[model samples]
Target chain A: MSIKITNGNATDEVAPQFSAERMVEVQRIINQYPEGKHKSALMRILHMAEEDFGGWLSVPTMNYVAGILNIQPIEVYEVATFYTMFNIEKPGKVVLEVCRTGPCMLVGSDNIIDHLKLQLGVEVGGTSADGMFTLKTAECLGACGYGPMLQCGKHYHEHLTTEKVDALLDAFRKEHSTSSNN
Target chain B: MGRKLLLEHVNVPGIETYEVYRKNGGYRSVEKALKTMSPQNVVEEVQASGLRGRGGAGFPTGMKWSFLAKPEGVPRYLLCNADESEPGTFKDRYLMEKIPHLLVEGMITSSYALGCNQAYIYIRGEYMWVLEIVEKAIAEAYANGWLGKNILGSGYDLDLSIAPGGGAYICGEETALIESLEGKRGNPRIKPPFPAVKGLWGCPTVVNNVETIAAVVPIVNDGGAEYAKIGIGKSTGTKLISACGNLVKPGVYELDLGVSVEEFIYSDEWCGGIANGKKLKACVPGGSSVPILPANLVCKTAEGTDRLMTYESLAEGGFASGSMLGSGGFIVFDEDQCIVRNTWNFARFYAHESCGQCSPCREGTGWMEKVLHRLEYGHGNLRDIDLLAEINKKIEGNTICPLGDAAAWPVAAAIRHFREEFEWHVTNPDEAQKRNFGIASAHVPLV
Candidate 1:
């Protein structure tokens, strides 16, 4: 549950001392907790820093979050590396997770993978030359009804065929280019 | 006798909302619960209802409620375990999405029954949209005086929140779920201090599945005796089933217990039939966790008659014949489906989802996955099948959480029926890969 705690206690606002703007969000986040136990927000701080610093957690960013939270650096490091949801290194601007579990695999997921590689010139876990899309494989995105699916920035693109994959890449380009035009 | 277990009120949508629900006699239970009956009555009503947990364990609902240790003036809790992360189980997710209010109303009525001032719906982090609906429904309940402080002028105060889990399948375990609620790593605590005694901030909590709570609304609405009149002995009330994976008409189906397994597949209301009009090969009858049953056993009785779908009926031959109605997730496989490959895939999923809490599960799951992966990829041998079965036996009742059993059951069931398939995979590795199943290639070497 994401509660809006506006009247949170004023804790020590620790920053990474790397980027000034990202350090501010970390401050407001730390402010939501009471002082002395700032370590409660270590993972949250790391998550925010990673997203703010271009889609992945750098080693220092995890270290910085550990510093801000008054937690063991290894503790933060361990958490940051443990979860598959979190990327340790820099991720592509658009990280696409293709569903590779049973249902998807049964329903022509291989063709979708081949399509992604053919179009993006990248294998699963590799970024395209333009750094626009990084293809990754994930186990069961829970969209079985829409097997052979892909997730682009929290949105599900399900029921993919070779044609659908091609069109999907085009749509990605069109949307990104449109956003760029603005 | 076939009874209506899951699909008692099918002709209605929005069964969660108060108004849409009220038309078909919904919150009347809450009204009756508030006006006349005491909390003990509500508990007794559930005890009479004979509703099972539906979250795989099939523990009796009333019994679980009675287990709460009432020591002095400590606060009790009702945590709705809506984290339906079991493979092939999507029933709870649909229930919450389709009838958020049904669960909310159930929570209100249940909280009143349990004397719980605070309740939480620990939803899976994957279902971000579900959290929105649940939170909104809770807000509406608060606005309508169904939640928070003197609810419906009954002078009972309650607060409800839905906390999202950060993608750990093991977290669905009650103890692990409690740990996750405290914003800690999702890992199971050793029992003895079961959630009933010291759960959720070290207070007594009754963590129930979303379907379990939703059942409360119906159980309270119609008297428990009436609910008991519906299903067979032990397994009372309807059960919501998410029947998928190679079904002709795969979707959510609610039906009464004691209905024959044949009827569930043949009846139009349920699966319709297998894909390509193919003969059924095997089924994970319950969620992904249950042992698989070969088509012959699934379609037969211990005495060779067609098997029924009741709890006892399915368990006629014990582990060999039984497949749990776990999480109400029924995954079917057609004759063309390879049990070895399918078992391998399930093993890989369990390996990935293990929270690394217990040594047996953490290490055992990984090893199991590797062996199954190798087998399915054609590097398997006759001994590999026995080895996998041996490993499952080792990990079976030896873990802190049911996750180990969940991981083991599929392998055990698959080997029980398809030992020959494992032998074939070992003898003809190329043929297994020709099917394009990629458990072998899925091996991303550990750093």
Candidate 2:
């Protein structure tokens, strides 16, 4: 696995930082904890930082987060890698997360995953050549009853079928093409 | 037709809002607990209700709450465990999504009862949408004066916030949850310094599952004894069963505990029977962690008594012939579904979520998944089955947390109940590779 940080550099000179508006929100999050214990805000801030600096937490980004919390850079690195959600590398513009755990698999998630791979022309955890989509499998996102689900951003597409997957991919392609052209 | 305590107002329009929920008697428990009942009185009532933890372990909720260490000048915290990552469980998510205020109401009552001035809800990061719903509900509570300083003028200042776990299943464990809450990796801590005594920033803390906290709403409203009257002995009150996989209607159903397992499977009101006119092959009654049961054992115990959906009844024959009502995941398998493949999927999930804290769980889970993978792909001999069982035995009680046992039980149960299926894969590798062996014969509706 290649640990590619942002700008292809892991040195301290990178000076990773969040945007101005996000820094204010980071302060609000830090205030949620007691004094001398602002480290509790590290995860929340990392989540925001990941959102701020694309969808992945680069090494510089992790170091910046550690700086905000007055903790060691290793603190942020340990947390970023420990969580499956935090991506250290750049992903495609649209990341398709399909649930392939027991319940989802029991209800045909495997077929859905295969369908996604074929449509996007990318294997699992592989990014599309056009940098439009990335296909990844999730464990279980608590949509067991509405199995065969996938999450894109905050929305969850549940009770999925092949037809639904096709429509979703088409819509995402339109979305990606439209957004990128701007 | 069963008593719907938590979800009674779920379908009522605008119950997601504070005004509508309050109008529908949503926070009556908060009012009752804060105004009429003493702190100890509230604990005693919950103790009388016999409500057990709904997050798989089946520990008595009231007993767990009573264990909170209340040292002088030390603030207590009540953390709501909304990290519903278990494969087959989605009931908590349903409750939070549909009726968010119900949880907020329950949290207020629980916080008041435990003398907690501040509380937090540690939800899984994947439920980003649910977090918004909960945050909106919390905002509504503050507007309605149900939260914050001097709530309802009872001089009880309690604040609730939502924390998102950074996508780690091990964080669902209490100590790991506390560790994650402190902004670190979610590694389970050693016992003796249990969360009750030392938790979340070295303060006395109590972590309750979302459903368990939501159940407190009805427990306080109906009184502890009255709430206990709803279900069978010890497994009192209604449970939210999240049924999925090969069911006609895969959704969350709130059922009284004493309902028969057969009825739950086939009743139109519950799972609505298996889908596509297929036969019931097997089931994981609880979440992914519990032992999987064959069709026959699911409906009736080893001694041939009709099995009910209570905690005790589900564990009827111990691990040998019984399963658990763990987290009420209730995953049903149709005749065509392959047990070897399904078990492999669960093993893979465990291995992915092992936290790498213990050697047995980290190493054993990966080994089990690999062996199961080989068996499923028709690359295993007959001895591999015994090897898988041996792996489960070594992993069962070796880890610091029950995750080790959780990973082992399903593998052991699958082999015990379906040994012939394994041997078939070994002896007839080519044929096994060709097609999956399915259980024949459809089960008639028992309800």
Candidate 3:
């Protein structure tokens, strides 16, 4: 079975809304498709929603996206659940998705996953107690030649050694700490 | 060095920029096709070039274009499939990241050939960084006269955009890509009226791989015959092979399709041989979906003829002793790597990626993964080996899409080439966990 991560029931909460500038950007994205095909912008808008609304899609958040496209709520929910990229449940601030497929495995991705699990003090799909980091194993991210890699947000950290993992965690922790202080 | 049609200017600084790419003779194909040639004339040139799809299936690109049902007064769409999720393949991502303009140029040129007024590059979501690069290139093209309204005074109007897929490997399939583009689940639609007849938004559509579409830039610029002269027969263009797994140099390399497998594996110019001086145990010459070949059979056919890297040559013996050059994902396995473990890993990937549309693929992939996992983790009887083969036979041809066959072939091939290893895992479960089965005796003589 797939991993499910949810923070209690969020259905009763008010649906999140996009900001004015973000709404303009969403309109531009909808315009990319032909007329009456505003549904085509659903995926891009969901990505924006995920980024802006606490890093995961709550029930109310998906409903808000459905309202934006003027589609059925079921349409939004089915699509949100189908793709693995969207997080239905709340996650830590930083989600480290490491590639654990064939080529990466051959190049010692197993050891990297084990090392991450030990360092984070969590299992494969668990987040740390402080809600700082969540560990996840992903399928191929297409950087096969540069194996033993992980993706934190948009950047890919490749050729991972234990030392590189240590430095990465430290850097992320430092950045978070500095930002929170501000 | 082989001639690089698509990546000739890849090393030039700022090739990713439109200014630098335009300075190095980029967008010439768009000019050539739009300014002079008719749409049918462009198709004829591609047919003459003998260019097969660089995507896994080696179908003739020209033939696929010819099948587009051009109904009067209907808009046709061309989608560039940038969903590069095949396990061992990374060439598409590299090409898009390094020289994004080449794909932009190819998209415009090929769109013109198909008389398409709108196009989209459906890239995988994981490569968000690469998507940003291509989006910038597309914006630059729009800024110039290359895109949007009457190009080169040809009265042809084209508008291009990019679509991002939510993380799903099934989205790489063309139908699934179309579904995803329509903001739906990435379940593949049943085919009969292939995409040629009924596609995106119920209009005729043509979807081509990123590499396949990029090849059109060179095919139109220098004429088809010139492009056809580079590689061997049937495989008449340079191919980008992404070499990974236990290689001295593991990255993307473009080679003439007829280069010998031995030369590619051992040559200083190519992979530079196995990493750390380890002997090669086996190789998945194509992507992870294709059959794996034992070391002795990798460089030579069953008949002992040299195995060249062409589609026909790689598939010399029909899976009994041959494998396809699928997507040119050359994955090498060193002597220390474990086959059972690697096979289970791939099976798990398939299980995770399966869209659950077809029962055989949905259930069979999970079953195969479970059985393989059990065997790899040191708990399986001898019957589980045959059980895997049985499941493989059931899933090979029972699905609406090729994902079923793809999931079946590797398991089938691993057992075919390394049955003894599977048996060893069953009999010596504890020892198997301790050490690999080491390169099973000389190639098990072609059955």
Candidate 4:
């Protein structure tokens, strides 16, 4: 699996730093733990780093987070790879993590997954040719009642249909285009 | 119409807000516990209530609290396990999303009872939106003087914060939750030094489920004996059942424990019967980790008794002829649904989520997933069913955490009850791909 860099063509050599505002947020998170245990802030910081560093963690990004926690880069790498939510490699602008567990499967999530693949012109875990969408299957996302669901960024789109998926894609494409033009 | 303790005011508009929640007798538990009742008194009330852990294990909540070790100058902590990742369970998320303050209030009262000033709600990352909702409620709580220093002038101080986990099902286990809270990989620690003795950052800690803590509000408000009177023997208090899959009404319902399993499935007040008017093929009454029961075994017990929703009732005949009320994740399957495929799906989930800690769970779960996959897709022999049973045995009792047993049970129970279905998959490979083995004709006769 090749890593796709979402930001400027910077490799692992690039050292990413949180903006001044995010630094304040980082300090607040660090303060939530006891003294000398700022390491407790690693997971939240890694989450913030993923968001700020173009939705994936590169080696340098992980190292930067380690530095913020005053821990080793290996510590950040171990955690970032352990959790499924963290994207170790750069994904497309939008990643559709569709739930494919038992309950979701019982409610036709398989059909939803196949439909998403057909619409996106990419197989599971494959990014679109245009680098617009990445389709991935997720375990039960705690939204079993509203099955056939996919999570995009922070929003959960549940009780999905083919039409809703199409509309979502169109809206995402439109949103990206408008934001780029701005 | 039975009873609702946690979600009683759920439908009230703006109940998620502090003012609205307070107006609806929300923080009365906090006031009552802090002012009148001592911490031990609060603990005794919960013990009297007979409330079990709502997260799955169904351990007594008050007993778990009484086990907390208190040494001089060592601060204790209370962590709420909000990581609801079990395949068919979403009740915690529903409870947290709809009534955030119920949990916040429960934390305050529970924290005061535990004599701990600092607590945290370790929520799964997928519920980020719900976390924000809870954080808003926490801020509302702080503003209203229910949280922070010397709350309500009772000379008791407490601080509560929300910690977000980066998506791992094992973290739902208390030890793994503490490890994750300390910013490590969510690997389950071996017991002997349970979290009650040595927990987060080496302090004596108590971890309770979101629903378990939220239920404390009613226990304190109504007294433990009153709370105990609501449900059948042992399995006291109302439970939040998140019903899904092939159900006419697939959503979270506040069920009074001991409701008949048949009524819960067919009554309009509960699941309202199977979807498309189809006959029930099978059901996983609890979360996917529990044993799967066929239609005949679900509504009635092995001895021809009516199956109830209580922990003891649902688990009447042990794993051989019963299932658990685990986390109240009621999953229904209709006639057309395939048991082999659903079992494979669940195995795949456990495999994907195994945390790769203990070899039995880490390796055995994957092995089972592969074998079940081949069986589901119509490329297996009769011996493969026994091989699955073999794998289930190896994984069940040989792990540091229950995740291993959880992964093993459904596959074991599926094969035990539906061996005919597995054999049909092998005997008629091509047909199996085209259609499911609808309801199994060879159900074990009730004793």
Candidate 5:
């Protein structure tokens, strides 16, 4: 993962057309409310950046958010960085966040990890050599009862064993039939 | 793993259905309270149970309920706080998502006791799915004749609503929860009326946490004294602890409150032990809002007393050496993790979540986070660390609510326990980067 950060309130030099378009729409989202409180849309701005920048925000994308919010880049970067849902860098096309915290750990997160390593031939944070998925180990996903869980995109696949992990990966492969260049 | 207690009634064959709950001794409390006992008696029963608010502060639930000024002809509201945003805490989320009806049952019983005709559950916005589950449960409740006009022929009426809140840690504060329910900016307000006197739409209100209210059903059902006998002094009944960070067993464990911290961590019943055979370095007994206790102090206080999990035992010497059992968020740390980096993570959270309500919290959290971030990256002087301490002192009680204090405690405590690690961060930069994230995370799954 590559991330570039700057100190000052930076501008969006290499801006995307859609990001700029959505920033204007987000400005209208701000206009819905009274002046001096546009910061209420801070979450929505970060949300837009997440959608616009391929499911994550770069430091530059956060800077663009700050420029649009008419606040310091630090302000936008701060919110972008805090939330667990908001990612600073792009994971692979199939982002697999396996739960590494307690409950899941108790119920065989280790065996599930070994299976993913053997199947994907990469370490936890490393992407598959083919780049089909980038695996990141995360803190608790909060589904303790359904321990040994793995999240494939937005859905949580819980009570996972080595076999269940394989089945989920196979289903993902079937869903994404073709390979592409990044 | 320790067996489930609070989650026992969640999905047991017929738990969701009212008939099933009644068969299991459910709304018998509401019936007993109305026909057999007065509202004051119900209040007294809860008082006798020695149950404290599960929402971080550990305030007395009965005292909070009685503090309500339920004057004649004025409407009273019971706002059930389900905004479980504390990092290590996921107990309330489980209660709301799995057995939405349990909260519904507790709400009706408590609202009846407080003379409140209406109540609301304010949940975190990220858990939008919880709103649907709870709403459907509320519908079931209304259809079953357990809620709304003359409930069970007891001449009592109760209505419940669900309010979703946007992300802001400070909104966990009761006053801020009320402001969010009113569709405002979700900022903390000055507390003089204290919610009991004036809250939610300017009516007499009682804002209890999801755990606090849920505990009520058990208290009233078992009778107050009986419930009080379950746990230790001042910390009665069972508590749902969300253990996280570097621990071996990290899940929600519902244990009687008197269980010692050692029993909770090492007995193989709760968290089991620390992962990777690593030595325990420190622990934040509560959520990040409380001071972090060093491993030595945690094993035994500065005066060399074994640290137990009860309210009094945990906070024996106060902040100088004691830590609070806040929200029961036991975050374990191993020696390998950089204290400065870990502290930076929390400081950043507080600063972003300050709500900009007061200068002390608003600017103070920001400055401390920035200085800590730079200091952690080897760009700070010894003077910067001193400056961070001074800034925290100003933020500690100078805000409208406890948010200010919440922002400062971890920063101060992190330094108190591991000032050398923080200084090492400034003295050396390259070494900090090589350190892995969250000491327990495996680069690969275990085989």
Candidate 6:
């Protein structure tokens, strides 16, 4: 019910932008469409920008994407906010999006959501103190049969239990620490 | 056992690779259609097969292809709608993930028939893994000289690619998918200048579901008449159902269209009955957008005839005592499940996914979600039930897309079939807060 807008104002400072390798991929995506219709690649380019900058689409990063696509800045913001996957604000290093739609709820997705809340020590849509994880409820991600599922990054962890959640969190923690160290 | 046309080679090891898929007789449709049959003949085969669109609506696929307006100097496209985000549907995801090349083969065959020099698989962003798999399959198709120029020396050039959608369920609609394909906010366009007339960069286009496109291969290979012989009546060919919810086995199953609803729920071959040996309470036979049917109506139509899985049979009683075969996202509920809560969950989903385009769907979905949330948590009166109905009535058929109707149908059906459940939440507010209104039979025993 709440209207969430990126509003070109996550913070005063924009810390980072896409790397060269990501830029190359962005260029490839832009080139996927015909000339002047590169706007067709906005979603993919925004995805690249999301991964390259942080877990979210900051105003500056979105603007950078607009520049790459040669589209208006508001055009980038409009699309980035329209999609649920594109988080305008910075999310935790690991985002736990648990499905809470009908099929998933019938199969105990609510329990999984409650378990994530307790284990992560964060309420729904809240981030942990260490900024390691963000707990959020998602609509169906087309994994109805594999209900009680959550998507963290590119992977879908289906048929989840409390123990599986703990193991996944532990794995995510390890991955986070390893990446931070690097 | 029903014929497994699309997924026949799904379990074959290395079927993900082009070699294994080809070895297992994949792309036979491509070779057959390209070398033997003309493009018009391929369309005719699909037309004769009586193949319907697999993406919820059940539109006639061949007729839809024939609608394309091929003006001079205009490019026509065939987009594979892989944004399978309906609440209870995941069949396309399973199909694309397990057998990526199946979709690729289907796309090539479809492209040739539609005269689309370039096509796209516009997949949901949430299915990132699936996007990669399909893209890899497309790459393999290119390397094998199937996707790129002069495929198999037939001189039928085609280019195929995967377009990732930023996770919006509304994009699953054809016009919205086209809008998203153009990198917009996925607002469903008003019809009249339909996609066939003007689509994807203002070019004529045809958007088919992943399953519909994949089924083209089988239809082309076996001929449309042979494909038509597989299913009963207007609903022909095998249907892939993504069975889910409280069932013994929650997975995708391919079955002939004429299978009885009872057989599908109880038989070991399909859902294997409700979980924990519980009795069936209700089911959304198709996707979440369809009406929810009570156990009695689901088993037999209003006329006392046995209900079958075919489109006509499932929708035998219209919206009064029937539902649709929308995308075959069959969701089953055991006796322990609460219809009110499930309806609320769906309301929340539609609310979240509503693109805020038309005021009825935009405002109505959110209003319904809020009201249902309150009712489920045990703080509502009987008037709220009627209020929900009123909102649904206003929302249905009042928007640019079917999303309004999709948001309206489940709410309307839940109240239509299970009004007592909502009223029980209102009357027994204290008890409802303590526990869900489980299967009505469990709470209020029959004489």
Instruction: Answer with 2 or 4, whichever has the higher lDDT.
Output: 4
lDDT of all predictions, in order shown?
0.75, 0.87, 0.90, 0.89, 0.73, 0.88
* True-vs-predicted CA distance for residue B341, candidate 2, Å: 0.8
The residue-by-residue lDDT of candidate 1 on A1-182, one tens digit each, is 22232212223353334456656655654543334434434545554565576777766666656655655667766656655667887777788888766656555676788888888998889999997899998766666645678877547787678888888788889988898799
Interface RMSD of 2: 0.8
Per-residue lDDT of model 5, residues A1-182, tens digit only: 11121222454576533444664566554543334545545565565566667767887777766655567767666655544556787777688878654334444665687788889989988889776787876554555545677766446787788888888888878777754321
Candidate 1: tens digits of C-alpha lDDT, residues B193-240: 888999877889899998889888878888899888876777777887
Off by over 4 Å in 3: A1-13, B434-447
C-alpha positional error of residue A124 in candidate 2 after TM-score superposition, expressed in Å: 0.7
Task: Please give, for residues A1-182, the per-residue lDDT of candidate 3 as tens digits.
Answer: 11121221335557677888888778778888888787888898888999899889988998788777777889999999999999999999999999999899889888899899999999999999889999999999999999989998889999999899999999999999999999
Per-residue lDDT over B1-447 for candidate 6, one digit per residue giving the tens place of the 0 to 100 score: 657999998999999999999999988999999999999999999999999999999999999999999998888999999999998899999999999999999999999999999898999999888899988898999998898889999999998889899889999999999999999999999997999999999899999999999999999998999999987899999999999998999999999999999999999878888889878888898999999998889889999999999999999888898889889999998877888889998998899999998999999999999999889878988889999989988998999999999999999998888887888788877777764346333564211
The model with the greater lDDT, 3 or 4, is 3
Better of 1 and 3 by TM-score: 3
Instruction: State model 2's lDDT.
Output: 0.87
B430 Cα displacement, candidate 1 (Å): 2.9
**Candidate 3 lDDT, tens digit per residue, B326-377?**
9999999988777888999999999999999999999999999999998887
Can you list the residue pairs that collide in candidate 4?
none
Chain B TM-score, candidate 1?
0.94
Going through the candidates in order, their DockQ values are 0.25, 0.76, 0.79, 0.77, 0.06, 0.78
How well does candidate 1 score on lDDT at residue B350?
A: 90
Q: Which digits, one per residue and each the tens of the lDDT, describe model 2 over residues B1-447?
A: 577999988999888888898899878898888889888898998999999998888899889998999999998999999988888999999999999998999999989889999899999998888988999999889888999899878898988888888899999998999999999899999997889999989999999999999989888988999989888888889999999999999999999999999999999988889999988889999999999999889899999999999999999999999999989999999887778878889999999999999999999999999999888878999899999989988999999988899999999999888777777677767765653334211111211
The DockQ ranking, best first, is: 3, 6, 4, 2, 1, 5
Cα lDDT for residue B30, candidate 3: 91
| CAPRI-style grade of the A/B interface in model 5 | incorrect
Interface RMSD values, listed in order for every candidate: 3.2, 0.8, 0.6, 0.7, 6.7, 0.7
